[model samples]
Target chain A: MSEINSSKTVSIISRQAPYGSNRAHQSLDIALAAAVFEQAVNYIFMGDGVYQLLGNQNATSIQSKTLVNALETLDLYGIESIFIDSQSLRERNLTPKDLALNASIVSRGEIAKIVRASDSVFNL
Target chain B: MSTLHTVSKAPSFRLLETCLSIIQAGDAVLFIEDGVYHCQQSTELLRNSEVKFYCLREDLIARGLIDRKLDTIETVNTQGFVDLCVQHDGIVNWF
Candidate 1:
């Protein structure tokens, strides 16, 4: 039995790139926390947010931890479903191979469907 | 005396527009944080040759924008940021 009375489907749409702002971290943290609570969490990377999935990131010089570390833990928390906007990736000249994690490349219509199915939406 | 204008937000915000409008010749604008996204809008900034343009190298690299950065804007490190501050008489922060 889940701890919470209602397990709402929470969707976190991250639009900012990692290290540029805290929004990316904030979204990941919330998604993990929500998943821990036994809620169905959907994490979607769009726009600049797609940059968060890029590999070969070393933030040591900047004195910041690489967000990819936390991103790797999402699956361990049972948050397996990760989505990335296809247009965003194409516009940024990034391909699925460039990302550190495995995420489903979704279109605008598909993204809208996910958002619509979500019980709660957080656009960061 | 010159000013070191720091922009920490994206061009989507009117802050950059306003900052550019009021910036004087010899002033420098340093794009930090999300401001590095302004690399896409470098052509607009090029209109003012008198004003200098810079971006935090760490921030740019973190966003995977190092290769995509424009030639006109110089990349600087944190230490270089401090140097720019020292070189200017005042600082203007545009959020």
Candidate 2:
């Protein structure tokens, strides 16, 4: 059982905004925590979660830490596999260029394939 | 085959109702996280169903609901939680 969970691919689906709420941060934290355990972790940004990737975020005005800055720490945590939903980006009128981070834009079908392949999926 | 439905919210019983209607008898319903709070009151959802109901032992303890009247709800530990998931064919997390 430990072997299955240890070798299992986990996909963390983020569906909320980055700031003003704990959901998105908690999702990222869980991914980071799982990665530390040497588990395979993949991140999927959809819906309002795409906002976390937006560049030039200045949360100082609101006395909050910029979510984009926190997201930049993912690479250092060894979590490189990241994806953004194409339809969600279109709906939000955002392009890859608007994002501070580099990630693949995936179709909904592709997202489903990732979920199906994962041994466990954590949705936020 | 049975499916383990993990509920994580208090007012999210709408999905539970839908799940109960579709699930066959002898299937189990294990409530965890904040959903364990719902075990306090006997709702229509709990009264009419023949499905076995359960709650996370640790969660109930954490919430200070230990020794409370939880109807027919049984408590299971994390290991038991995993076992229940393994016993079931699928898992539907309703949060």
Candidate 3:
């Protein structure tokens, strides 16, 4: 009972790619903190957010920090429920093999279940 | 259980006004990115209520509006930004 009371599930929705704005990094920061606190974390890549999962990103040309390294660390934090939007991936012509990290390709219906199960949702 | 509302757009955007309307009495509002340009306009939101107001220090310096901030709008760094997020049960990013 104590364990159940102490842990809250947090869903962090990332909706943008790296380099274009600061949001991608900011959302990661929140997820990192939530993981450290031992909360169950779900990092959902939605809409443009799926772009963040692309592998071998080098922002050096753009003079921005590459999130490729951080994206790889999601598994280490016990945040195993990373979900990428299926529609977004198909629209962008990307496949699971294109992403740096492995993620569940979820349809909108599956995504809704994830959201409904969360105690809190962070929109970034 | 209050919400930490983050606004990253300028006052001209409907986002800022929409945030103001939905914010409850105890909610905290933080101005980030171009949202710092609207710090003065936000003063009206805090005039009669207990809603907390903060602006990201780095964003304010970048925009060159440091000296003109209203007395009520406190400035916070990135760590403070994280603390605010933790203090609230929920977060609403009004982009």
The most accurate candidate by DockQ is 3
Candidate 3 on B44-72: residue-level lDDT in tens? 54564567889999998888888878877
Candidate 1 chain A least-lDDT 10 residues: A112-121
Which candidate's lDDT is highest? 1
lDDT of 3 by residue, A10-121 (tens): 9888877887888899989999988988999999887678888888788888887789789898889888989888878998999999988888888776765665566888
DockQ, candidate no. 3: 0.11
For residues B1-95, could you state the per-residue lDDT of candidate 1 as single tens digits? Answer: 67787889887774566556546668799999999998855566556888899999999999999999988899999999999999986665655
In model 1, the runs with Cα more than 4 Å from the true position are A1-3, B1-95
Global lDDT scores for all candidate models: 0.83, 0.78, 0.80
Put down candidate 2 lDDT per residue, B1-92, tens digits, no spaces.
45566777774545466445445555687888887886787788887566788889888888888777465788899999999999876565
TM-score of 1: 0.57
The local lDDT score (0 to 100) that residue A123 gets in candidate 1 is 67
The residue ranges of model 3 lying beyond 4 angstroms of the native Cα positions read A1-5, B1-94
Q: Single out the weakest 10-residue window by summed lDDT for candidate 1 chain B.
A: B14-23
How well does candidate 2 score on lDDT at residue B49? 63
